[model samples]
Structures are given as C-alpha cells and as structure tokens.
Target: MKVIGINGSARKGWNTQSLVMKALDGAASMGAETELINLYSEPLKGCLECFACKRKGNKTGGICAIRDNMRPILEKAHEADAVIVGSPNFFGYPSAMTRAFIERFLYPLSSYMMKDGQHVRLLGDRVIPAGMIFTMNADPKSYEMMNYQATLGATTANLQYVLGYAEQYNSYMTLQFKDYSAMNANMFDGDQRVYRHETQFPIDERKCFEMGRRLVAKAKELNQ
Candidate 1:
C-alpha cells in the first residue's frame, strides 16, 4: 500500500508541514510506503480551463493534460491507496496552492453523464480514501463566528463526493510566529495568545498520525 501526503504551506518546518510529516510517519508505521510532496517547492499551475480532460473521447485517461510539476503529483494521487492533503487556512478557505492542487486533482477524474434523466458523476464508481488537515488561527468556538467551519465543510463535502471517503483534522488557534516581537502582537491579547506549542502541538501531531493510520486501514480494507 502507498499513501501520499501533500503539504500546501510555503513555509517549511511550519505547522502545516509538521502535521503532514507526522501523518506520513503514521502511515509508514502501518507498513505502507509513504511520501510527502511540498507544493511550494513545485511549479504548479492552476487549471487552465482548457477542457482537454473533459473533451469527449479524450485520450488523457482521467489525468490532467497540463504538463507541469502538478501532473506527476496528480498521477501519483490517482494511483495511491490514500492521500492526505494539508493546507493552512487563508481568508477562511484553503490557500491558493491547495485550492489549485485540489482542482487539478479532481477535475480530470470528474465526468458529466446522464443517469435516470439527471446528471451524475461518471467517475463516482471509483473510491479512494482521503484525509485533510487544516491549520488555522481561530479557535474551535470561534470557527463558526469566523465562518471557517462552513467553508471548510463545503470543501470536505466535495472531496468526499469525489473520493468516496474523506475525513479532516483541524489544528486550531495555531501560533503564526515564533516570536511575538516579529509582528504586531498588540492586536492579539498577549495572555491568550501565549500558546504552549511544545505541549499542545504534539497532541495535534498525534491526531494527524491517527488520521493517516486510519486512512491506510480503511484503504487496506477496501482493497481486501
């Protein structure tokens, strides 16, 4: 079994990468081949709306026609038993890189067809186990107030619809900086902003690990 983790964060060694790595480690523990792809390091372009993949009788075989760094990654995702997508929340949604990666990943596999006189997903018969990790600055209670939960829910629904099974892990109230002095710390309550990164971050990391392991287990079951 093989599981691939994709990190959408531009900053290395940050919260998003940490969680993705931890998840890959967990999958590794399950005797699954694991790999991590950092999107920031790759030359990925957004979907060009070229309709090449959607063309009738196209020969692409459910793969994006765009020839770039993302093409190989999308192919890997298509072949992998499980995929873990990690992205830091930007403006209550996924970062641009993450959004682009997902679009390219899903678009080619999607097809329009009529079923029972209604449009349906042609590739819906294929099922893949997938997981998502989101790191955000808002706390759980404030996620609704910030509208992050609703926006993220829609993303999760789309993934589930396309991938068959999808789950998410959230690390909320993330520390954006190592030192408060590096940025305008006055805007945040210093006392409330003081997060125990050393302690709590590990807990979040363990959750990511479990998510990876769970995906692998589910994929294995499906394969069986």
Candidate 2:
C-alpha cells in the first residue's frame, strides 16, 4: 500500500520536514511505498467562502469547482492507502498551508454529508486511516497554541465522520526552550534544554528521527 505525506511547514526542511521524513522512513522500513508532498510550495490557499461545492451540483458527487493545483493533490490524495499530515502549530492553530489543503479536501465531502437532509453516513467506508503530527516551540507552563488541538479534533472529526475520508489519530511534539539561558536562570525548562549544553545543533534531532519512525509504524498498522 502506498502512503502519502503532506508537509505543511513554511520553513521547507525545518521541524515539519524532519518530522515527516522520519515517518516516511518508518513506513519505508516496513515496506510501505510512500511519498511526501510539500503543501507550501504548491499553489493553493484556504477556502474562498465560495459555496460552489455545496450550492452547485457537485455535492454528493465529491467535486470541487475550483480547478487548480488542488485538483491534482486531491486526485493524488485519494490514491493513497494512508495519509500523514504534519504541520507546525501557528498562531494558535495549524499553519495556513495545512488549513488550505484541508478545506478543499473536506469541503466537497462534508457538504455532501451535511447538505442532504439525511443523517446518512456519507463517510461510510470511504475514509482511509490517517495520522497527524503537530509540532511547536512552547514551554511546559505556557499555553502556546494549546487550543489548537481542539480545533484539529473538530476538523478531523468532521472530515472523518462526516466526509468519510479517514480515521484520525494524532501525535504532538513540542520543544520548550530559550536561546538565552538568562530566560531561565536554571537553564532548565522541565528537564530539556533549548540547546544542547555543548552540541553543534541545538535542536533535538534524535527526537525528530524517532518520531518519523513512529509515524511510519503507525502507517503500516493502518495499512495492514
């Protein structure tokens, strides 16, 4: 089975890419064919508030009126057995790149479910198994983007239960740190330091790699 990854980080190969690559590698190790797609580089944006999918005849048939790059991604997205979406939490929510893709992908599907007066399980068996990874830079006591998880849950549920695309299990990883040790006199922000006491790279590269591997494992389980 082929698994697909959509990286939603604007920083190209930053935390998002690193995390997604790990998941891809884990999937590869399990003999699952996989591909990673970068959403930021793709030409697309959030829903235009255009009700074309819901207002027009595209409902139930799962057609998006917006004929753009999203069309191709939608085609590719459906071809996969599993999808892993990774994004860095931005401004108390997912990045714009991720939000844009989700809108198009779920709009038609959800409209079909809601537009009709029936409580029909439009999602039924059409939904694939999906996983999500969210990363952020926040300290333990800080509520940085803490509310994002709820928003994600609501969106995922609507997409999974209403649109019937996939089951959504999620993983969360964050870095709590400060470049200036003066921020925390002890240089201790709940056990982990922002930078290695003496490493060339300050970030936790190992954690990133391990997370990738775990994602792939989950993908394999879902595919199987």
Candidate 3:
C-alpha cells in the first residue's frame, strides 16, 4: 500500500513538516510506501472558476486544463491508498498554502463525475481512505472544549463530508506561543514563523515520532 503526506507548514524542519514526516515514518515502518510533499516548494494556483471542469461530456473534469503547480500533487493524492495533510493554523485555519492545495482537490473528482457513463459518486467513501493532521498551537483540550467544533475544523470537516473517506485524525501541537520571538526560542529559531504562533509554539518532539508511527498502524488497522 502507498500513502502520501503533505507538509503545508511553509518552513522546513518546523512543527508541521516534522509532524508530517513523522506520520510518514510510521507508514514506512509498516512497509507502506509514502512520500511527503512540501507545499511552499510547489507552485500552486488559486481556482479560476473557468468551469471547464464542470462542462458536460468532459471526462477530465478540468483537472488537466488548469495550468498550475497543484496539478501533480493532486494527481498523486487521488492515486494513493491513503493521504494525509499537515498544516499549521493561521487565523484558525490551515495556512494559505495549505488552503490553496485543498482547493485543487476539487478538480479530479469533479472530472470523474463528468466522465462518459461512470456513475458511483466519484469521490465516494470506497474510493480511498484519507486523514488529516492539524499541527496547530492549541492543545487537544481546546478541541474538547469546543466540543470538536472550531475554526481549524473547517478543512477536515469539509473533506469528511464531501469525500466520505476520512478514516483518521491525528494532531501534534505547541500551545500558547503566539509570536516570532517566543516561537524562535521554542520551535525553529524564529525562521519558522509560518508555523510558530501564540498558544502553540513547538510541537512535542516525541509526539512527532509517535504520531507518525500511529499513522502506519492506522493504515494497517483500516486496510487489513
């Protein structure tokens, strides 16, 4: 089995990257193939609403038509057996890089639906199981306090609803450090402000390792 992990943290060796790597490590240990895509390094574009994908009788769903950086990653994500995305919270949501990546996912499935006589909910539950990792500044308690409802929940919640293949969720956080100075001292020497923030500065290093291993276990549990 193969799985892909995406790091949307924008900074290398920071909280989001570390966590996504960790999860991939776990998947690797289980003999499952995996790869991590760095969002910042990729050139992704925003949705132009060209409607070429939605055009009737077009089987490709406008996926191949959009000329942007997200095309390759989106293709791999759809083909993988399990996929995971790791993003740091920015204004209570995944960073802009990550958000843009999520939008690209709409293309392929939309195309599958428009294809010639293939009808079964293109992105339906049985397609492939997926998961997400929110490497934010908040603690698990925050999600509990909110009753599992919070702004950071927008992406995962939407994916689960739309794709119905969401199989697991894992998190690693560094809470309460909101500024660059604090984050530099705690997480990545101030260079990773994109990942460092108040309420969550540095993720627990051990947890990073554990979260990754858990992903591998999860894949086995679900698929086997």
Question: Which of the numbered candidates is closest to the native, going by highest lDDT?
Answer: 1
Q: Could you tell me the TM-score of candidate 3?
A: 0.70
- Give me the overall lDDT of model 2: 0.60
Each prediction's TM-score versus the true structure = 0.92, 0.69, 0.70
Per-residue lDDT of 212 in model 2: 44
Q: Score each candidate by Cα lDDT.
A: 0.85, 0.60, 0.64
Clashing pairs in 2: 22-212, 23-212, 123-164, 127-165, 128-165
Higher-lDDT candidate of 1 and 2: 1
How far in Å is the alpha carbon of 199 misplaced in model 3?
16
Tens digits of lDDT, candidate 1, 1-224: 89999999998899999999999999999999999999989667888999998787898877889888888899899899899999999988888899999888888776676779854754445567888899988788888788787887767777887777899989987778777767787665544555546667899999999998899998878666
What does the lDDT read for residue 43 in candidate 2?
63
Clashes of each: 0, 5, 17
Ranking by TM-score: 1, 3, 2
